[model samples]
Target chain A: AQSVTQPDIHITVSEGASLELRCNYSYGATPYLFWYVQSPGQGLQLLLKYFSGDTLVQGIKGFEAEFKRSQSSFNLRKPSVHWSDAAEYFCAVGAYTDKLIFGTGTRLQVFP
Target chain B: EPEVTQTPSHQVTQMGQEVILRCVPISNHLYFYWYRQILGQKVEFLVSFYNNEISEKSEIFDDQFSVERPDGSNFTLKIRSTKLEDSAMYFCASSGGTGLSDTQYFGPGTRLTVL
Candidate 1:
C-alpha cells in the first residue's frame, strides 16, 4: 500500500532560523505530493503541492517543497522561520484516484 | 475566496447514538471527501463523493458510516451507531476538479466526542 512518512516527530527552531522537515513516500508510480499545515484549533491548510514539474514547487506562506524521485522524498524547506510558523506539518501522497495518504505529521515549535 | 464550511464545530453524544455532520462545499467544487483525525494521529481518508455517489471509501468507512449530497450544496456524513472509538475530528474537503492535481480545500473540522 502507498504510504507517507515524516521522520521528524518534533522540531524546535529559533525565530529567523532555517527549517527543514523531511518526508519520504512509498508508492508504485510517480506520486503527487503535498504539504499541509495545521495550527492549534484550526483546520489543515494547504502549503504546497508537487504533481509534475521542475521538481521544486513554491506555495503560500513563503513555503516550498522539492520532489526528489531518486531519494523518494519531498522535504519542506523555509529559509527563515517565524514565531507564527509554529504548527503541525503533514506530508501526503495522492493516489491517482485522488485519495490522499498522510503522514503522522511533524510538530514545529519556533522560539523567540 | 470561497471556502468549505462545516456545521456544529463540536458534538458530544452517547455511544450507540446516531450523529450527522453537515458540510457546505465550495460552490464550484465537483469532488468531496471526508477525513478523520484521532487525537495525535495522522488524518485518514474515509470516503470520497462525486455525482451523488461514492467513488472510493476506506476500510475505516464501513456500514456504520454513510455520506450523502442531500442537496445541491449540502454534503453530510452520518454515523449510524457511534462507538466510543468514534471520537475524533472529522473534516470535509472539496476540490474544484476530479484529478489528483486539483487542490483540496478543507473545512474547520467537527470534533466528535462519544461518551
Candidate 2:
C-alpha cells in the first residue's frame, strides 16, 4: 500500500536558522508527493508538490522541497526560519484515486 | 482567493448520537473529499465524492457514515451513530479536476469530540 513516513517527530530550530524536514514515501507507481503544514487549530496548508519534471519545487511561504526518486524522499527546506514558522508538517503521497496517504507528521518548534 | 469553508469549528457530542459536518467547497470545483486525523495519528481518507455520487471510500467509512451534496453549495458528511473513537479533526477539500494541474484546497476543518 502507498504510505508516507516522517522520521522526525519533533524538530527545534532557532529563528533565522536553516531548516530541513525529512520525508520518505512508499508507492507502487509514479508517485505524486506533497508537503503540507498545519498550524495550531488550523487546517493543513499546501507547501509544495512534486508530480514530475524538475526535482526541486517551490511553494508558498518561502518553502521548497526536493523530490529524489532514487531515495524515495521529498524533503522540505527553508533557508531562514521565523518564529511564526512553528507548526506541524506532513508529507503525503497521492494514490491513483483521489485519496491522499499522509505521514504521521513532524512538530516543528521555533526558538528565539 | 477562493477557499473551501466548513461550519462549526468545534463540536461536542455524546456517543451514539448523530452528527452532521457540513462543508461548502469552492464554487467551481468538481471533486470533494473528507479526511480525518486522529490525535497523534496520520490523516486518513474517509471518502471522495464527485458528480453528486461517491467516487471512492476507505474501509474506515463504514455503514455508519454517509455523504451528500444537498444543494448547489452544501456538501455534508453524516455519521448515523457516532462512536467515541470517532473523535478527530475532519477536513473538507475540493479540487477543480483530477488532472495534473488541479490541486485540492482544504478547509480549516471541524474538530469533533465524541464522549
Candidate 3:
C-alpha cells in the first residue's frame, strides 16, 4: 500500500525566510510524489510533482522539491516565504492505481 | 487556463437525507476523481472515473455513495443517506490522463455538514 507522512504538523517562519516542508512516502515500487497547497477557503493547488527523471523539480510560486529515493523523501522548499504563502501543505503518493494516498497536512504560518 | 469547478460551496443536510455534489471538470480532461477531507484529517481518495465507468475506488466508497456523469460536462457524487460522519469537504478533480505523470487539477471543495 502507498502512504505518505508529513511529520510537521505546523511550522512558523519569518517573512522572506527560507521554508522547507518535510515529506516521506512508502510504496513498493517507484512512487509518484506530489506537493499541494491549500489556501484558506481555496482549493488544493499543485505545487509540484516527481514522476521520474531529474531528482529536483520546480513548480509554481517559486517552489521546488527534491526527490531523494534513499530517504524516501520529497521535501518542498522555497527560498523566500511570502505572507500569502501561509497555507496548509500536503504530501501524497500514487501507486499503480489512480488513487492518491495523502498525509496529514502541515500548516505554515508566515510572520512578518 | 481551464480548471475544475464545483457547485454548492457548502451543503447542510439532515442525517438520513440524500445530498448530491456537482462538478464540472476541465473541458478536455478524460479522468475524474472524488476526494474528501474531514476536519483535521488528511485528504482521502474516494473514487476514480474513466470512460464513464469507475476505474478504481477506495474502501471508503461503499454502498452509500454513488457517482454519475449525466452529461458531457458534469460529474456528480451522491450520498444516498447522509450520516454525521459524512461531514467533510468533498473535492473533485480531473486529469488529462491516467498515467502517474499526469497532473490532477482540483476544484474548490464542497463542505458537507450532516446533522
Candidate 4:
C-alpha cells in the first residue's frame, strides 16, 4: 500500500514570510500528487496537483509545489504567508484506482 | 461555478444505529467518491462511484457500509450499524474525468459523531 508522510505536525511563520510544507510519499511508480487546504469546519480545497510533466506545478492561492523524484517528495511552497493562510494542509498520492492516500496533515500557523 | 454539496453538516447517532450521509455532486462530473477523516488523522478513502456502480472501494468500506445513487443527483452512504469507531468526518468528491489529471472538487463534509 502507498503512504504519504508529512513530517511536520505544525509550523509557525510570520506574516509575509516564505513557507514550505514538507511531504514525502512511498510508491513504486509515478503517482499523482496533490495539496489541499482545509479551514475549520470546511471542506478540503484543492491547492495544487502534479500528474506529470514539469517537476514544478502552480496552484491556487499563490501556492506551488515541486516534485522531487529522488526524494519522493512533493513539497508545497508559498512566497509570502498571510494570516488567512493558517489552516491544515494535506498531501495525498493518487492510487491506480484513482483514490487518494493522504498524509496525516500539517497545520500552518501565521503570526503578525 | 458548480460545487459539490453535502447535507446534514453534523450528525450525531448512537451505537448500532443506522446513519445515512447524503451528497450531491457537481452535475457534469463522471466520478464520485467518499472519503473519511477521523479527528487528528489523515483523510482516508472509503469508496468511489462510476457508471452507476462501484468502481473501487477501500477495505474500510466493508460489510457495514454501502453506497447508492438512489436518484440522478443524490449520492448516499449508509452505515447499517454504527460503531464508536465510525465517528468521523465524511467527505464527498466529484471529478470530471477517469484520468488522473482531473481535480476532484469536494463538498463540505458531514461530521458524524457516534456515541
Candidate 5:
C-alpha cells in the first residue's frame, strides 16, 4: 500500500520570503512523485513531477522539488514567495495502475 | 494548450435520484480517470477507463457507479442513486499514455451536491 504524508496543514509566509513544504511517501519501489496546486474553486494545476533521472526537478511557476530516496521525501520549495502563490498544494504518488494517491494537502498563505 | 474539461460545474440533486456527470478529455489522450474530493480531504481515485472498459477501480467505485465513453469525445459517469455522502467535487483526468509515468492532466471538476 502506497501513501503520501504532508505534515503541514497550513503555512503562512511573507512576500519575498522563501518557502518549503515537506512531503513523505511510503512505497516499496521507486515512486512517481508530483506536486499540484489548486486555487479556490479551481482545478488542480500540475506544478512538477519526478519519475527518474535527476534528483532535482523543476516545475512551472518557478517551483521545484527535490527527491531524497533515503528519507523517502519529496519536498517543494520556492526561493521567493508571491501573494498570488497562495493556494493549496498537494503531493501525490503514482500507482502501478496509473491511479494517483494524494496527500491531505498544505494550504499556503502569503502576506505582504 | 490542451486541457480536460467537465460539464455541469455545480449539480444539485436530491437523494435517491440518478445523476450523470460528463467529461471531455484531451482529444489525443487514451486513458481517462475519475477522482473525488470531500471538502478539505485529499483527492481519492474512483476508477480508470481505457479501451471502453474499466482498467482499475477503487473500493469507493462500487456497484452503483458506472462509466462509459458513450461517444467519440464524451466520457460519462452515472450514479444509480445519489447519496448525501456522495456530495463532493468530482474531477476528470486523462493522459496520453497508459503508463504511470505519463502526466495526467485534470479538469476543473464538477461539484455535486446531494440534498
Candidate 6:
C-alpha cells in the first residue's frame, strides 16, 4: 500500500525565516506527489505536485518541493515564511487506486 | 482564473437524515472527485466520476453514499442516511485529463454536521 508520512505534527518558526517540512512516501512505482495547505476553516489549496521530470517543482504562494527518488522523500520548502503562511500543510500521494493517501499534516506557527 | 465551486458553505443535520452536497467543477474539466476530512484528520478520497459514471470509489464510499451528475454542470453527493461519524468537511475537486497527467483543483468545501 502507498502511504505518506509527515514527520512534524507542529512547527514554530520565526517570520521571514526559511522553512522545510519533511515528507516521506512508500510507493513501488514512480510516484505522483502533492502538497496542499489549508487555513482554519478553508478548503485545501494546492501548493504543488510532482508527476514526472525536474526533481524541483515550484508551487503557488512561493512554495517549492524537491522529489528525491532514493530517499523516497518529497519535502516542501520556502525561502521565507510570512505570518499569513501559518496553516496546516499536508503531503499526499496519488495512487493507482484513483484515491489519494494523505499525511496527518503539520501545523505551522509563524512567529513575529 | 478557473476554480471549483461548492454550495451551502455549511450544513447541519440530525442523525438518520439525508444530506446532499453540491459542487460545480471548472468549465471543460473531465474528471471530478469528492474527498472528506474529519475535523483535524487527514483528507480521505471518497469517489471519482468521469463520463457521467463512477470511475472509482474507496471503501469509505459505501452503499450509503452515491454521486450524480444529474445535469450538464452539477455534481452532487448524497448520503442516504447520515451517521454521527459522517460529520466532516466535504471537498469537491476537478481536473482535465488531456493525456496522462493533470492537476486537480479544489473548492472551498462544505462543512457538514450531524447532530
DockQ preference between candidates 2 and 3, better one: 3
Question: Tens-digit lDDT track for model 2 on A9-103?
Answer: 99999999999999999998888888999998899999888888999999989999999989999999999999999999999988434678899
* Superposition TM-score, candidate 3 onto the true structure: 0.96
| Distance from true location, Cα of A17 in model 3, Å | 1.2
| Candidate 3 residue lDDT tens string, A26-54 | 98877888999999878899999889999
True contacts kept of 6: 0.60
Runs off by more than 4 Å, candidate 6: A95-97
Checking candidate 2 for backbone clashes, the offending pairs are: none
Between candidates 3 and 5, name the one with more favorable TM-score: 5
Candidate 4 chain A lowest-lDDT run of ten: A92-101
TM-score list, all predictions: 0.97, 0.97, 0.96, 0.96, 0.97, 0.96
Distance from true location, Cα of A108 in model 6, Å: 0.5
In model 4, where do residues sit more than 4 Å from their true spots?
Answer: A95-97, B98-100
- Please write out the lDDT profile of model 1 over residues A12-104, one tens digit for every residue: 999999999999999987788999999997899999999897899999888999999999999999999999999999999885458889999
> What is the alpha-carbon lDDT for the whole of candidate 3?
0.93
Q: Mind giving the per-residue lDDT tens digits that candidate 4 earns over B7-87? A: 899999999999999999999888899999999888999999998999999999999999999988999999999999999
lDDT of 3 at B51: 94
* CA displacement after TM-score superposition, residue B33 of candidate 4 (Å): 0.9
iRMS, model 3 (angstroms): 1.9
Candidate 4 on A23-102: residue-level lDDT in tens? Answer: 99998677989999999889999999999999999999999999999999999999999999999999999844488889
CAPRI grade of model 4: medium
DockQ for each model: 0.70, 0.68, 0.69, 0.69, 0.70, 0.62
When summed lDDT is taken over every stretch of 10 residues in candidate 5 chain A, the lowest stretch is: A92-101
- Model 3 chain B worst lDDT window (10 residues): B96-105
How much is the TM-score of the A chain of model 1?
0.96
Pairs of residues clashing in candidate 3: none
Candidate 2: segments with Cα more than 4 A from true spot = A95-97
For candidate 2, lDDT tens digit of each residue in B1-115? 9999998889999999999999999999999999998987888999999999999999999999999999999999999999999999999999888577567789999999999
